[model samples]
Target: KEPGSGFWLKWLGAPSCQRGSYAFYKSVSSRAQPDGPVQVWRLGEFYFIRCGPQDPVCIAEVTLLWEDQTQRHLLASTRLYFLPEDTPKGRTREHGEDEVLAVSRKMVVRVEDLVRWSCGQPAGWSSSLKLNGLRKPPQSSDSNDKNTTTNTTDKNGPVERQGVKVLSYPQYCRFRSLQRRLQDGARGPGLQDPHLLALGAVRALPNTRVMYCRDTFNHPTLESNTNFSWQFSEYLWSSQQISFRPSACIPFPLFV
Candidate 1:
């Protein structure tokens, strides 16, 4: 929460993801204390933040600290702008509305990490999906083993890997949909809301932050089948299997 703000901030992190604890700092640098005496609370995989009256109006930094004392890293160093009042004059959307990523993105797990987490569970489709891209090809395993040993030395010391794993477009969408449905439960009909889950991951290549299964292309196949029929053409087709046959010979009278 920002200082003098009427509403609290919610962190929308991924479900079932356990990465690390996070804290928000008001100062630009880590050495300075946090603004407004921020308090962090964890419930399951989600974390919530609250600040006292003394907090700063704009937060400058956010830090992610591992449970182990040996590791503490800065997740993001960005300015979080906030509105001074609860009400908006013209636009209802506040400035700091998109800050949900400060937490939820952490739930994205690696293939190896997912395997470790799902160990001992009954083998099925979910297990197979988790191992989709991660399974090493038998032919490449020998060469990969040798290369792994040779590349073990890190010139800059061992660093924790970050960023999302690469997957084909279709595979990524399917994996995201399944992960979200499993985490947030099926919504509406059969897991209709693909984006219902609050989880998200950083995408490769372009390196954009994307919600799992968020098909921005707006393709027909990716859309959910809603029960409600609003279009007149849809009603005619579904109920009568007949479309309006426009007769060029038929004349219509219009009042001027």
Candidate 2:
């Protein structure tokens, strides 16, 4: 007599008693009308389901509706785990004037976008609907290489640059140390910091140009021709003949 009484009957996997049951069953079998979309709702702390028939003897498919209203067909014979008692509850309620209701909630499994059907001869018989969570993209260790030279660029020029000498161990160590201190989580001086200025002085070597050094957001531009200058190459024991001048000097905050 009740609307959802059919659900109980269907869940019980028993033949309906009344004439209406036979009619409903026939409609489901003939037209293959979904009883209803798959739903996720919390009962107390756990979620329960009245998914479509599961018996291999039956001929109905189960479909789940996502938040975006996209429909996904689940594997016919897959077993689904309902929300556990410890799981957080979501807001959803039953349909009106019916013993059964449709609810909305997120799933744990990551369902594919396409719809799947049964593998039967007519390909109609199906079982419970499966729910899945969204998948995350993989992390990349090679992200730093994006700014570095690539194989294609190597063909245009020598793999190494000419007329540029490597920094001595002490000079390199000092520059690297200052860079680490600036990048460390600790709040330190801005570009005006004496340490940064000292590092800049050391980087301004004769015949050795610091091509560019940019921030993650590309806000601060520290290029060889800009934001850098030298009066003499004191580190290399040279003067007058070795004088540097940055096109411009701009100091920007490290944090927004």
Candidate 3:
């Protein structure tokens, strides 16, 4: 969210990222008058935020947290999630209650927008995709470690990870199909996609906001896939993917 000044006023200069807990976000869990054992915001953790009165509670992953030097506050960059019902092809009995479609980019949010940390069993895939280097790297066992492992039972059995993970392997297909679908649904199927306007000629529309997303270019969310780097044009679908592509009415800036 921005103020009426027509430019970003709070985050004035290049910000620095914190290591462990980052700065205090103080979600619903840590709202007590004194300190409590609430989990602080960390990279890769999933959280829920209600952006407005009528906006549905959406879930997202914390990608990065930077402290604005001028205003002395922490702001977050995230990858948004969408529910099965919100997708282009609506929901069905096959979708799990916890299932979601993940996406990235378009805005930087205030840490205050976070409502609560989403901690529970994550939706599973037939053959789990590693999503290896997107956020955390695979851990190698250390020589000093013991062979014993812990078990967490919830009437089902033990699980590996505890939160939602992004699955954007086929996102170019989603984005291209969605762009066509959105146009077809609005103006009938045979219509073409809207014309492309140069960055200078573009104007901010009614519901859009002015954003600066260049800062996160050096982030993992923007990292290129390792496997399909040098492929031919026809085989580019797997390589031409975007990190985040959800089935939600995502608020995006026309000019950013």
Candidate 4:
């Protein structure tokens, strides 16, 4: 584990688990002391290795252990290789300031404002609201006092109350799934939020955004039959199997 020691990174696919008692995997390794600026390695169709000024390289060793009633065993091990020069080491280059487009910056238009303006009621319509730099308008002192009184009344009138709660990461996913459902015209009191209609419109627009999954909703739910620890263990293992990648969704937005 000393600095610059050779290391390994392994990627195992779920399809490989089909082997009755064995697992298949692929890995990349680095030379103990690479002399060049770039080192390249490949394992399978599922990965692309790139070395550039913007990316750093790291290597790790992976181990898998298994235990059974009869004995314990080391299931798998792998090494990963990379080069330090895989990152740029030379003099820096000069760069110019990036140009900003006015239209692109003005993309977020309020639906209500647009409707009123388009209906030829300039007097009734408010100025177009942009999503960027949006802030809630300040409330008047009179309204704040009224809200305080209303809150007091509601606190006294509530039939029952549970503990206050905040959404967890998985619950956020569930909320997004529910939003997708509501967008598809599902009936629910959640539709009472005026902004939900605009959200549904955004989801309905095609080729204009990057979405989590195009065909289905993904949420985390625990099985009632499993023990809490077992359920958590499964969730952790499944989460580790997922790999998130970043790439330009719209490579050339202006040109397109």
Local distance difference test values of all predictions, in order? 0.23, 0.21, 0.34, 0.23
Candidate 4 regions exceeding 4 Å error are: 1-172, 188-256
Minimal lDDT window, size 10, model 3: 206-215
Q: Tell me how many clashing residue pairs each candidate has.
A: 3, 5, 3, 10
Better of 2 and 4 by lDDT: 4
lDDT tens readout by residue for model 3, 110-179 = 5544422333333332124222111111122441111111111233543233333332334323433443
Worst 10 residues of 2 by lDDT: 22-31
> Please, what are the lDDT tens digits per residue for candidate 2 over residues 1-256?
1122222111112222212111101101111124433211111111122222342221111221111112211111111222111113321342111111111211111112111222222221112221111011112345222111111112243232111112334554564565455457432334443445455323221222211111111111111212122211111122111112121211111110
Model 1 lDDT per residue over 107-191, tens place: 2111111111211112221232232221111122342221111211133532221112223355556656654644564443442
Q: lDDT tens string, model 4, 144-177?
A: 2211111111223422111111122344355456
Model 4 residue 31 CA deviation in Å? 46
lDDT of candidate model 4 versus the reference? 0.23
TM-score of decoy 1? 0.16
Q: Which candidate number has the best TM-score? A: 3
TM-score (C-alpha) between model 2 and the true structure: 0.15
- Order of all candidates by lDDT, from best down to worst? 3, 1, 4, 2
- TM agreement with the true structure for every prediction: 0.16, 0.15, 0.35, 0.14
Best by lDDT: 3
